[model samples]
Structures are given as C-alpha cells and as structure tokens.
Target chain A: MSSKNLIIVPIFNEAWNLPLLFERLGALKKSWDVLYINDGSSDSSKELLEAQGSNFIDLAYNIGIGGCVQTGLKYAFEHEYDYAVQLDGDGQHPIEALSELLEEVNSNECDIAIGSRFKRDKKHPVGRTRRLGIRILSSTIKVLTGQTILDPTSGYRLFNRKSISLLSENYPQDYPEPESVVFLLKNGLRICEVPVRMNSREGGISSIHRDGIFYMAKVMLSMIMVVLRPKESSHGSR
Target chain B: MEADNLVDINRVQYIAIAVSVVYLLAILYLIRGKKIREEYSLIWLLFGVVFIVLSIWREGLDWISNLLGVAYPPTAIFLIFFMAIFLIMIQFSLIISRLSRNNSKLAQDQALIKQKLEQVEKKLSEK
Candidate 1:
C-alpha cells in the first residue's frame, strides 16, 4: 500500500512568510498533504492561514513550539496518516529537503529522519552561543544513548507512524527537540540525519533567541532529566 | 526547671494562637462564601490547625526543636511554616501545568471538530 504523508507546518506570527512558504511548498513534486498548526498568534496569522484554504489546527493560546508541533502530530495520529513531516513556517527549512527526509522514512531506514545543517554542507553560520548549546546537547545525547544526532535542535524532521503515535501521546513540552531525540533513542527507535541546506529566517525572531543562556541551561537540565527517567518498554504504535 | 519553662505560655504564644484562630476563621468564611475551592483550601486549613496546635502545646515545639538540633524553638515553627508554603506552591504549580496541558488538548480537539464540521457542511451544500 502507498503511504500517506502529512506535512505539518507549525506557525506562530509568521504572516509575512506564509505567502512565500505556501508558494514553495505548493511547488513541491510530491503529493504529500499539508497541515498547518497556528500557535495562537496575536497577528492576522489565523485569517491568512484560513485564506490559504489548507488543512490547519488553531490553538486557543500560545502553547510554545513543542505543544504546537505535538498538536500537529496528534492530528496526524487521529487521521491515520502513515507518515508526518514537521516543517517550520518561518521558511528557514528548505522545501527541497522534504523529498530526502520522506524518502529516508519511507524506505524504513529510520523511524525518524532529521535534516541536519552540519551533515555535509556547513553553509548556515550559527552564532557562537547557540552553536555551543547545540554542541552540548548533541554530545549529551551521544553519551547517554550511544547515538550521534548532528542537529538535535533542528525542527525539520519526519516521523513514521510508530513515532507519530508515541510522540502524539507523550511529548516534551519545553525544549522538546533534543529531549525527544533522547526519548526516541532510549526507546530503541532508529534515527538518521540527512544533510540539508537551511535558509536564514525570512521573518520574525525565534522565541528562544532572546534568552540564550537561560534557554541553554534549561535544555541541559531537561537533557539530564530525560536520561535519568525510567525507560519505556512499549515501542510500537498505540 | 526545663519542664516548667516548656509548659509556660508567654504573651507571644497567646498572640500566635489568636492569629491562627483568625486565619482559620477567614479560611472557613471563604469556603462558606464559595470563593475558594474546598480541595484547594484543605492545605491552608491543615496549616492553620498545625499553627494552633503548636501554639497550644509549647512543650511539643521545644521537644521538636531539640530533636532537630535547632537552637531556638521559634525557629522550628518558622521552618515548618516556610516548608509548608513551599510545598503548597509546588502543588499549585503542578496543578497549573496539568490544566495548561488539558487546555491545549481541548483547543486541538475543538479545531479538529471544526474542521470535520466544515467538511460535512460543504458536502451537504454540494449535494
């Protein structure tokens, strides 16, 4: 049977970028369906998304990035989507990487495929502090799970049916990307990273960019907690 | 001599007992007025009862202070009060977190329902 793919774009106050994002995604060659999750934007993002006439889930309030993405996953799970890809609405994640990510998951090579900026072409120049934070998290995951994930903080990810069910049920709320990698690894789920070109943000600032130090500290603490927490035995989809 | 010192209740102890009684009355009034949920106010009530108990039985406070190696008996009361407040704050934070999660889930569910309803309405109009 052919797999059904759902591209989940979690947006928060990215009205300016939506037009270009919609254009780029619309031009994709694959027949994957798109679902946008509006994370309670104060701007006219909801109206703009509605005008697009695509599938979308509107959150009542700003529940942060993790909650917004998890809502998309829950929608995919309930709708019985075979595979779901989490794409950012900021236009930073290139639509070209979608094919490679979906191909990895479709071939059963890995249950979750991550688009890494550092894999092959290191074109995206990251700030020093943010780069250090990413390094710390990546190293922590390696030490704990014996797996090397190049970009643990990347939002560009594809999840198979099993991962969708598991994450939809229980996902980390704050700073979920790295903690989720640890959780998936501890549960014996296969993860692979594919090299992808990431563009600079076209509009809006990152929610975590303001408090870099504090955010890094919290992420480090969360990584420790993820490792210390007891393991789950069930690996299959519920 | 120490035993007598423990049994002796001073003016400060009387003031404490009076304050505890007033606090307990306020909690009861709030509960009666339906301003505070019973489940949430239970901890406050328990704290008020503990304060009254400690004020009435001065000897018990001294015993506890000595057992815990605290130099001053009043320090023991302050320690317990702060500990209780900290615990109550933690409980409230946990409740807020759970409520936020449920709120987000409800919003997501509502969005899904709205989407399905729209689809059905569109189909009906087409037919």
Candidate 2:
C-alpha cells in the first residue's frame, strides 16, 4: 500500500447508497484511505459516514458540493496526502476509474486527472439540453484558461498535492465544476482526462430540481462571470 | 368632535410620542449591533414615531391618507403594519437560515471534539 494514496468521498443525504458505496470502496482496498466529508444533511448520512468507520470530516452546514469538496481537500492537504480522488456518493462515479487516474498521476506528471464518461463510452445518459450546457461550459473553460478539458463537470477527479493545495484555498461557491476548472488552469496546473463509464443514479433523487434547466442558464452566466474575474495566486495573502 | 374624546385623544397622542421617543433612544443605544433583532426593533420604533406624529397631526394624517386614496386612518395604519410585518418576516427567514447554519456547525464541532477525546482514551487504554 502506498503511503500517500487517498480517495476523498463527499456525502450529503445519500444514506440509501452509503452502504453499497462503502462496500464497493472497501472491496477496492488497494492501500488507499477513504475520507468522506458529510455535508450538513438532515438525514442519517452523518450517522452512515460515522458508521462506515472511515476517516471523515463533518462540515458545519450545507455548503453545497463546492464547499464539501473543499473541506475534504483541506483535510487531505493538512494531512499531507500525495493524491486525492473525489468520488460521488450518488453511485454514478465508477470506482474502477481509480486505476486509470493513478496511472496518469504516476506515469505522467499531470497535476489532475478527470473521468470523462461522455467521451469514454459515447453513451452518457445526460439529456441533450444538458450535453449542450456542459459543452458550452467546457469550451468556455478551455477558452478562459487555455486548457482543454473533456469533462469540466465531472465530480470524479484525482488531484495531486499541488492541485489539492490550489483548490483548497480558492474554490467557487456556486456551480463549482466549470468555474473550478478555470481556477485550476489559471493557476498553471495541467488537467488530463481518462474515459470511465458511469451509470445512472442508483438511489435517491438527483439534487437537480424541477427548474434545473433554468439552473444551467444561471450556472453558465455565473461561470462566464467567474472566468472574466481575475484570480489571485495560491501563495498570495488571501 | 366631542370635547371629552378630543382631550382623551390628545392625552393618548402625548403618551404615544413619549413612548416613541424612548424607543428611539433604545434603538440608538444598540444600533451598533445592527442585527436582525435590532433591525426589527428599529422598524417598530420608526413606526411608533411615525404613528405618534400622525396621531398628533390629525389634519396632516388625513390629508396624506386621502392623497394616497385611503379613506380610513386605521386602513392606512393597517396597510403600513402589513408591509412592515412582511419585511420583518423576511428578516425572520434570514435569521432562521443563520440559526440552522449555527446549529449544524456547533453540533459537528461538538461531535468532532468528542470523537477526538474517545480516540485519546482508546490510545491510553492500549498503552
């Protein structure tokens, strides 16, 4: 087991999937430690994260995906882990992709590796509208940061120490995925992607509300605003 | 206008003004905090002062209300009260949102501290 290998999972009200998520994660037991940071969920997700008996950090409140992931990254950085992989609790992310990410991190000097389901299988289940939305954001991220990313919205990613340090300090508060990609690239970190298959959500409803389509427009506009804004350095006094 | 009732109304107006002045002083005392609670109180205080002035200036009150097309003084007062209440409710919602955040955070912190203590105790026992 490598000393610095880590997988950080952020959980929020995904109690139904926690048991299976933990089982699959435990089966992989390839010397990687799992850290689940439970967002302020009213459900038993907190109890499940605690019961799973893995290392975790409990957030103060519902800080959304951006803040939850940031909390996990901060823990990883403070504890000096070499790499951190973020897997979703909703069971859509593939655990097998962990290998591909590790390979990239080890063989290549890549700072971050993302799992691109759409590019991988060409059968990703995202609706047409969503595909369009994601593309606009992906291309926008590319233009803003001069970095090409296939899946800017992927929650499944592996970050090395440098990437982790960069994100832990400066993360977007709103629709964080596309905005975060820009942030990473603007800070001079290279991002690469590996194809990984993802399944539809196994349990619990998607957090995207009935007005989620509307949310995409809002996210798109906000991402544009974020890209337009200037970024401060990681070492700069925040 | 009945003479006795006019005297009673005048007395009530004076008392109301006095109360409003005291409220204004109290709001000034704690405006530094400027929190939701204080803001709510400030709204009430301002309304009190406004109501006091309107009550004393009967013709002026009627003129403003009539200009606004509200016939009844109580109706105008009710309308303002409802609007102020709406603003206060919004403030209440904000406070609830903050309270929920504090509750979740304080509980998580407590749990973390307790978990660390248990880990310490387990290590001591193992040693």
Candidate 3:
C-alpha cells in the first residue's frame, strides 16, 4: 500500500484568497488528503469551504495560529498519516515546494523539513526589519539548541510521524513558529531546511505586521522559555 | 495630648470597620446574585472576614506588629493586605493558566470530532 500523506491548511478569514488556494490544493488532492481547519472565520470562508465540499473542521472560536495548527497536527496524528505538511491559508507558502519537503523526510534525511525562504532563494524577500528579527531569532535558536535555522519564522513546514506525534502533544500556543524549532531540536529530533521561494500574502493582514516590535520581543522570550523547559525524558529510551 | 491620640486611633478604627463591612456586603451580594462562583468566592469571603476581625480587634493588630517587629501597628495592616492581594493574584494566575490550557484542548478535540462526524455522514449519505 502507498504511504498516506496529508496537507493541513489552517485558514482564518481568508475569503479573498481561498479560491486560488483551493485550486492549487486541488492538484495535489489525487495523491494527498487535504484537511482545511477553519479557525472560526467570520467571513465567507465557511460558506466557501462548504460550497466546494471541502473536508474541513470549523473551530468553535478563534484559537490563535498555534492552536489552529496543533488541531491539524492532532488530526494528522490520529489518522496515522506517514507524512504531514502545513500550508498557510494566506497564500504565502508555495504548494510546489511540498514535494521537495516531503522528499527530505521520506529519505530519512530529517524528521522535519522546513521550506526556507532565505537559504539561497531570494525570489521573495521580507522587509528589512522583519529580516533582522528573523536573524536574531535564528541566532537565539542556534545558541540554545545549536541548530542553525535560516528561516525560523517560515511557516512552510513538513513533518514525519515522529515529529507530528511530538508536536501534536505539546505545541506552543502564541507565536509558535520560532519557538517550535527550538522545541523540536531540544527533543532530540533533527530538523533541516530546504531553499524554496515563498509568495507574498495575497490578501489579509500578516500577524507580525500588526505588532512588529512587540511580536519580536514576545517570540524571543518564548524561545528562551522553551530552552529552559525540561526535555522529554523519553528521548533516551526511544 | 494623650486623649487626642486615642481619638485619632478610634477614627482610624472606625474607617477600617466601615470599609470592611462594605467589602463584605459586596461579596455577599455577588454570591447571592451568582455573579461569583462559590469556589472562587470563598477566598474573597475569607479575606473579608479576616479584614473585619483585624479591624475590630485592635490588640490583634498590635500583637501581629509586635511579632513582626514593625515600628507601627498600622504597618501590620498594610503587610497583611499586601500579602492577601499577592496570594489572590497568584491564585488568579493559576486559574487563568488552567483555563487557557483547557480551552485550547477543547477546541482541538471539538474540531477533530466535527471532522470525523462529517466524514461519517458523507459516507452514510453516499450509501
């Protein structure tokens, strides 16, 4: 039997970009099962999903992005998917990179593969300040876990069954991306990055843009906390 | 001069008693109206009772101050009040942490179940 792969798309009020995302995701549906998680969207997103007969789960209320993604992870874990990929709903993550990410994990190269926008690819560039912030976070992760992650803030990621089970159990809630890299590394799981071009969001406000300075400070603090936390004792036994 | 000092102390005592009474009554009213759950109201109620006791028992405040070696008896009131507020704040923080943890877990479970039910329903409909 072929391996079961899942693409978890976490959406929140992305009515404007949903059509294009759905179309792009449709091409992969033949080989992968798509799960759309509606994070209590207040737009036409719910209706759009329903009209298309898309397989999705509507959250009762707005849980932040971390919680939204965790819900997807939990579904992937329960379904026993061999590999799972997370693609943002705002169209920033390129669906074409999914295969490359899957290859890294499928070949036993790493437990988790992150689609890095900065390794060598400069097709899509973030703002100067945002780039600086990600650099600081990258160094922090390096110092804490000795892992050099070029794009710590990149949301485009793929995980194998091992990483999925770990993250689904104890994923961070607020500003999870950077902290999660440290979290996974601290748990003894290998993480590698592949250079991939990203698309600027089609519509809707970026979470970091709303409170850039404060967001940087909060994410930095959370990464420190994750480092200081005790590692799971199951590392040695497993 | 000694009589004036006594009168001032009495005035302070009266103010403390009045404030404690109002606070206690407010807590009772909230409990009666079901505004505060019984589990959480217990702490406020206990604090109100302690406030009333310390306000009326001048000797008790004096004794606590003597025990702590505080120069002034009123300083004892401030210490006790600060400690109570600190404890209550810690309690609130604990409660909030548990609430947020539960909330996310509930959302995750609800979403998964909803998806499963939809899939089952779809399968049934196809039949």
Candidate 4:
C-alpha cells in the first residue's frame, strides 16, 4: 500500500508532449510504474507509445477522456496496484506537485486527491467559456452530492485502492469528472482537491476548443446526465 | 388462465378488435424508421402489418378460426404472439451470424501474427 507503486496517464493525439512527459515520468520511474492509456491517437502517438517501450494499454478507438481514464484505472485494478494517478497527456497538469499528491494519499490525508486550479495557487487557462461552464457544472455537482468541489473537471487526481476499485468496476462513460466526484462521495470515500498549476496546451487543438461555445453547453449538460443518473442496480462484473 | 375463464367469452370479439387495432398502430409507428431506410426493424414491422390486416379482416379470421375449431379473437391474438416470437428468433440468428464472421476473422489474424513473430525469432537467432 505504498504510494510509489503505479500511476496511469491517459494521452490522445498528444505527440509533442509525450517526449517531455516521458522525461518527467522517467524521473519518477524508480518506484512508480507509468501506464499510458492511448485513446486512438491517429498521429505518431501509437508509434511513440510502441517505441517508448513502457507499460501501456491501447483502447480500440477514440472513446474520449472518460474512456481513456477508465482504461488506466481498469488496468491498475486488475493488476492490483497500490495507487493510481491520472496524468493528463496534454501537459496541463503540473507533474512537479506529484509528490505532494502522493503523500496525501499514502498518509490517508485523502482517499483521493484532485488537483484544483480554482484555489489561486495555480495558473489556469483564461477562457470565459471553460470557466463559466466548469462553474455551472461544479454548482450542480454540489447540489447533487452536498459537497462543493473546487475543481470538478480537473484531470489531475491520485486514487487509492478503494477509489480505483469502484471506478474500474463502473466508471462514467461520458464527461466523467463531476460524476466521479459525486459517485465517490455517495459511496463514502474521502475526496478533496489541492491547488496545482495547470499550464496551457503544448501543441495541437483540444477537442473541447474545436467545438467552442456549442461544446461548452453540450458538455455541461452531458456531465449532469452522467452524474445524476440513478446508479445501476446490477452488481458484480458489468 | 383462471382470469380468462371468469370473463364472458361472447364479449371477446368486441375487446379483441380494440386491443389488436391499438397494437397494430404501435407497431406501425415503430416501423416509421424502417420506411426511411432499409432497417433490421423491418422484419418485426412486416410481421406486425400482416397481423394487423389479418385481425381486422373479420371474415377471413372467422373462417380460419372455424377451421381451427377455436374462437376467432383468441386465434388472431395467439397468431400475433407467435409472429412476435418468430421475429425475435430471426434477430438472434442475425447476431449469431455476425459473431461467427468476427470470430473467424480474428482467428485468421492471430495465426498470421504468430507466423510473423516466429519468422522474426528465427532471423534473430541466425544473427
């Protein structure tokens, strides 16, 4: 149950960041194993992932962020890892603050720790649509779960055994962040967000930016449906 | 079965026509998607149409009912049930066929991959 066991980073069409991310990860490679969940990146991503020669999982196609994250958690759960963290392939997440997050999980500071940009300790992208949309989603999640999460859409998070087991069993299929917050809380898991610096994208346009204003509304609504739907009654191996 | 015996069989025709008509319309509405394009939904849809027409044509149903030595509405109702089961069986067959095709393709790919890997190993050993 030590913290420096394993971490999974989900990447999609993020070829530019891979080399730097891998270098950053190489520093943490001694005690931690990194598993990259490749989400059907039609770039040199698959080639790099294959050539990089590290532990990785390849999804059938581009199932988006939710699917990419879940695939990593599923691997961690099946392989019986002590801990798992979601490192965004986009390089927005600050990997320098990784030790702090790991320490929090290891000491039972929190069963799961999320990296928050809203706490003012970290720099965030200056986009009105993203800010406003995440704000709406956070408020709705608070109402649903009675817990006001500071950054419900943050991709950076560290999860212990309980957190990974639950997510791997039945994680959200779409727009998962807010829904996972409610899901973990409802099941009595301790969750909190720590302020962490989030950089702008290194290269290439994100899918969210491609859709722009229209995507903001669609994603916000999608998150609500995904988070608030009654959990399925069926148990054991979906 | 006990509930059926409690009801007067003479009033069956009046209720049967009403129930059959409603189900027929529902089946038709579901088939609206099929009308736009050739859909797998057509199989159930075409059968539903047949059941609707047969049930409504009272004389044709009555003659068949008389020949079968059963009450008219009950005959039509049972026939509709049978048609539904038949469609489900057809869908099941379609799924089975698709799976078999995928299974064969996967096996072939795996065999080809294994052969290539073995060739690579042979070359490495020679080097």
Candidate 5:
C-alpha cells in the first residue's frame, strides 16, 4: 500500500513565486497531496492561491514559520496522514528532492528525514555571518545531543506519523528549525539527513536577513533551552 | 506650626503626591470605563497606593531606604518606581507570550475545523 503523504508548503508573502512553485510541483510524476498554508499574508498571496484552486489554510495573522508548519502538522494529524513533507514556498528547497526525503521516511529508517545542503560534495555559497551562525548551531546540537546535523536550519523535511503527532501537540515558535532538531534528538526520535541541493530563493526576502545578531542569539538561546528541557514521558510513543 | 514641623513638606513631595493622586485616579477611571480589566488593574492600584503612602509618610520612606542601605531616601523612591516598572514589564511579557500561544492554538483549531467542514460539505454535495 502506498503511504499517505501530505506535502505542507508554508507560504508568507511569496505571491510572485507561487506560479513557478505550482508549475514545478505540478510536473511531478507522483500524485502527491499538497497543502499551502497562507501565513497571514497582506499581499495577493491568498488571491493567487485561490486562483489555483489548491487546498490551503488561511491563518488569521502572521505567526512565524513554526506556527505555520505546526498548523500543517495539525491538519496532517487530524486527517491521519502517514507522512508529511515540509517544503518551503520560496522555491529555495528544490521540489525534486521531495522523492528522496519521502523514500527515507517511508523506508522506516528514521522517524524524520531532513534535506541537508551541507551533506553534498558541491559547495553552496553562504554568507560569512550565516555560515558562522549555522556552524555554531550545528556544533551546539552536536555537543548537546551528540548527533551531527549538517543542516540544522534546513526547512525541507519529512516527518512520519509519530513525529507528526508529537510536533502537532507541541512545537517551537520562532526560528524553530534548529531548536526542533535538538528537541527531536532529545526525545530519542530517529533522524536522518539526506544530501540535497538548494536553489537560491526565486523571489521574496529571506527571513534571516532582517535581524542577524538578534536572530542568532535567540536561536542559540533556544537550543540551550531545548538541551536543558526535561524529556517528556510520552516521548517515542505513537 | 507643630504639624508643619512634624512633616517635612517640600516641593518634590508635593509633586510626588500630585503625580501619585493622578495615577490613582487614572487607574480608577480606566477600571470604571472598562478600559483595563479589573484583575490587571489591581497591580496598578497597588502601585498607586504605595506611591501615595510613600509620599505621605516621608519618615517611613526614609526608614525603609535606610534599612535597605540606600544612601538617599528620594533615590529609594526612584528605585522602587523602576522596580515596579520592571516587574510590570515582566508581567506584560508573560501575558503576551501566553496570549500569542493561545492565539496560535486558536488559529490551528480553526483551520482544522474549516478543513473538516469543507470536506464534509463536499461529501454531502456529491451525495
């Protein structure tokens, strides 16, 4: 039996990139379900999404990336989907990598599979500050959990039903990607990183560019908090 | 002259008393007008009362300041004011964090309900 997989694409003011994203995902050979989460966009993003007649959830207001993704997970949990794949709406995470992420998750090798840009041999140009921030987060996760996450900040990921349920109940808020990695590791959830190439965003501003130092500090603080947080008793259970 | 000698009434003390009265009146007005919830207004009311008491009892303020080892009594007023402000700020932060968390939960619940309703509506229409 084919696994019930739902693709969650959380969008925020990416009206321009919607058409191209639709085209790329539409070209996929596999018939996968996609849910577009409109994160309280003031732009014509909702109108564009409506025009496509795609399934989507319109949040009342912007609640950041974590809230958006958690909403999708809630949907997946309610609908009883076996697996959920998170794909960014900005087109940075390549649509072609979806299959590899799904394959890993479906194989039952890991409860969650992340698409790591740093795992590949090819060099992706990154800003010095961002590279340093990423390195700090990567090392922090490594030191705390003893698990090396090559791309702790990667938004592209696939979560099995157990993770979907767990995260649906409780998930991080702002800058959640790395912090969530630590949370999952602390909870003893199996994680695997698959090498994937990422394209520079087609359009729209990157969320990380707004507050460089403050964002980094918050992320580091969140990581430390996650490390110190007591393990949940119901962890690793269906 | 006896009462005047007993209380060291000064311009700063008068100003502090006036400010405290105004703050207390403002808080009462807000509560009466339903602008601020009664539960939250309690803290402001308490602050207003403390200010009023400290303004009226100069010697008491000095005694507390001396006990705290603060060199200047007026500086104690400023210090207490700042501490109250800081505590209020922390309270606001906590309230906002809770509100945002609930807001997100409400959004998620609403989205799930809407999706389910749409599905049911579609199924009914097909039948």
Candidate 6:
C-alpha cells in the first residue's frame, strides 16, 4: 500500500476463474493497485469485470498475451509506478510468493524477479513433454545469454521502473515468456528468480498445449531473433 | 520444316499476346475502380507490360534465354515469372507485418483512452 507497486493481470477468456483470482488478489497482505487488461474475451468476462467495479481495460480485440501484458506495463510506466508485477489470470502464480518478488525489487537485489516453479525442485504439474520443452528453452537461454534461468517459461514476474519502461515500448507478440527473458538480459537488465508453488490452471485450456510442437519451434526461433537483434541505443526511445 | 515451326511459334505468340492484353485491361479496370491501390497496382502493371513485350517480340525470349544460359526460352519465361512472384510475396509479408504491428498498437491505445475517459466521467459526476 505504501509502495508505488502495480500488479498487472492479463486476462483472455478465463471467465470461470475470474472470481477466484479476484478473491486471491483481494486477500493479499499489501493492497497494491491492480490493473486487469482484457484481451478481447468473447465470454462473460467483460460483464463480470464491469459488475465488480474493478479497474480494468477491455481491449477492442484480441491482441495475444504479449500485447495484453505490455498494455499493463504501459499503464504502470505512464502512472510512474515504482514496480510492476505480472500475474496470470489462470490462477497459477501464488499470491504468497509476491512479497518475495517485491522485496527483491524493493531492496535493489535485481531489476526483475521471476517467480519460478522449478528452481530447486524440477517438479512441475505439466506433462513430461511440455516439461522437456521448457527445459529446452531454458538451455537455449543459458547458452545464448550466459545466464542460467531455471524457469524461463514462468510468466510470474516483477519488473522495476527500468524494465517496465523498456518492456512497455517493446515486447514480444506470441509466446513471449522465454523470448522476453532473453530480451531483458540482452539489454543489461538483471533477472533473478524466487521459487514459488504454482497451482495447476483452474480454468481455460493452456495456450501452449493446443500447439505444443509448433509453439516450441516458434518460441525457440523468437529467442534466437532476440539474441540477434541489435541493442537499443536509448532505453525507451521510439 | 523450319517454316512449319515458325508458324507454330507465331501461333503461341498470338495467344500469349491476347492473354497479356486481357491481363493488362483487368489491372487497369481494378485501378480505375479504386479496388487496388495505385502503389500495389504498379507491380501488376509492370508485369502486364513485360508479358506483352515478350509475347510481341518473339526473338526477345530467345535472346534472354541465351543471355541467361537457359536451354529453353519457355523455361526462361517461367524463371522470370517465378522471380516476380517471389518478390511480390516478400512485399506482401512486409506489408502484413507492418499492419499487424500498427493494429496492436492501436488496440492498446484505444483501451487506455477508454479507461481514462471512464475515470474522467466518474470524477465529473461526483463533482
């Protein structure tokens, strides 16, 4: 409440889990401002958000998850919030681990704090093939950036002002998690992770499951492109 | 025997010339109706002109084939057509990428503006 922290929740068609996600968010210890950026949900999500009177922005059309999250970061950047945290609307990221992430950013420990589900323990609720896919992405990041990110695919993350400003202007479009990690690291931003227990998706199908093989291939290619991109001379220049 | 082959080649050229004329007319009609932007129509117009020239000048095709070291003049025509198609495809991809980027940026800005408008309305009503 005291700190200028904004929690960004990017929602698509998670109508079934919106109530529970809101409840968990309301139960958090610190009353940080929450911003929900809806990615053109065709379901009852817009009505629910309106009825609840929660602060949210319903996009005109679906722009994918990357654009949804970047909108929140843009809001944070415009409002001059000190830190911005990203949480999934599927109820995967634990609310309890938020404090640790904020603490790390608050103490200047790192520019970004990622809530990793497979830090010390390699156990995850996803299928073996999907787990292997994440492992491949992690290894790719390590090889490319020289930084071993235990869980590069984790969407639960906290970004400071520097990262918020940088990402708001430019973020990946499709399957952005791993590629954005490489993007941030390449720009001289430090990223560390805190182990957090994640809940299996409460509602809606996983995005990666529908196109498992294709998703892996695209994300891998995107990471390589990120590495090949020239560093921006100015951080937030258009 | 050589005279017979010449007649057959001229027949093929006549058919090609007819097709080229029709293609060029179609492109012009589309441009006149504003169905296709002038900028994009330029390439199609260029294609039509090239096709007509190649069809009218029978010796031009053979000359190009000889210049390119191609065994057959028909093969040379196909090669040029494919190269043009490749260039057009790349141009289309570039246009689509720029359009999608602008589309997403517009969507994001619209959402933000709507939110701000709502807040302003709420404040005005409270006052």
Output the number of the DockQ-best candidate.
6
Whichever of 2 and 6 has more TM-score, that candidate is 6
Q: A147 in model 2: Cα distance from truth in Å?
A: 2.7
Question: Which runs in model 3 stand beyond 4 Å of their true positions?
Answer: A122-124, A234-238, B1-9, B25-35, B62-76
True contacts kept of each: 0.42, 0.08, 0.92, 0.00, 0.42, 0.85
TM-score of predicted chain B, candidate 4: 0.46
Q: List the residue pairs that clash in candidate 6.
A: none
Candidate 6 docking category? high
Off by over 4 Å in 6: B1-9
Model 4 chain B worst lDDT window (10 residues): B104-113
Off by over 4 Å in 2: A1-3, A205-214, B1-26, B29-118
lDDT of 2 at A119: 71
Among the numbered candidates, top lDDT falls to 6
- lDDT per residue for candidate 5 within A69-168, as digits (tens), equals 9999989987889999899999998888888998887675899999987887647776667777888889989999999998898889999998998898
The parts of candidate 1 lying over 4 Å away from their true place are A235-238, B1-11
RMSD of each: 3.8, 6.1, 3.1, 11.8, 3.3, 2.3
Residues B3-108, candidate 3, lDDT per residue (tens digit)?
7766765887899899999999999999999999989989999999999999899899889999999989888889988999999999999999899989988988
By TM-score, the best candidate is: 6
Ranking according to TM-score, highest score first: 6, 5, 1, 3, 2, 4
Whole-model lDDT, model 5? 0.87
Report the error of model 2 at residue A216, Å: 2.7
True contacts kept of 6: 0.85
lDDT of 2 by residue, B1-127 (tens): 5776657657767876777778677676666566435645767677767776776777876787787799886687677778888987897899887775556445445545555576688789999
Lowest summed-lDDT stretch of 10 residues in model 2 chain A?
A203-212
Candidate 3 residue lDDT tens string, A83-121: 888999999888988888988776767999999988875
Please give me the total number of clashing residue pairs in predicted model 5: 0
Separate DockQ for every predicted complex: 0.49, 0.13, 0.80, 0.04, 0.61, 0.86
User: Which residue pairs in candidate 1 have backbone atoms (N, alpha carbon, C) closer than 3 angstroms, thus clashing?
Assistant: none
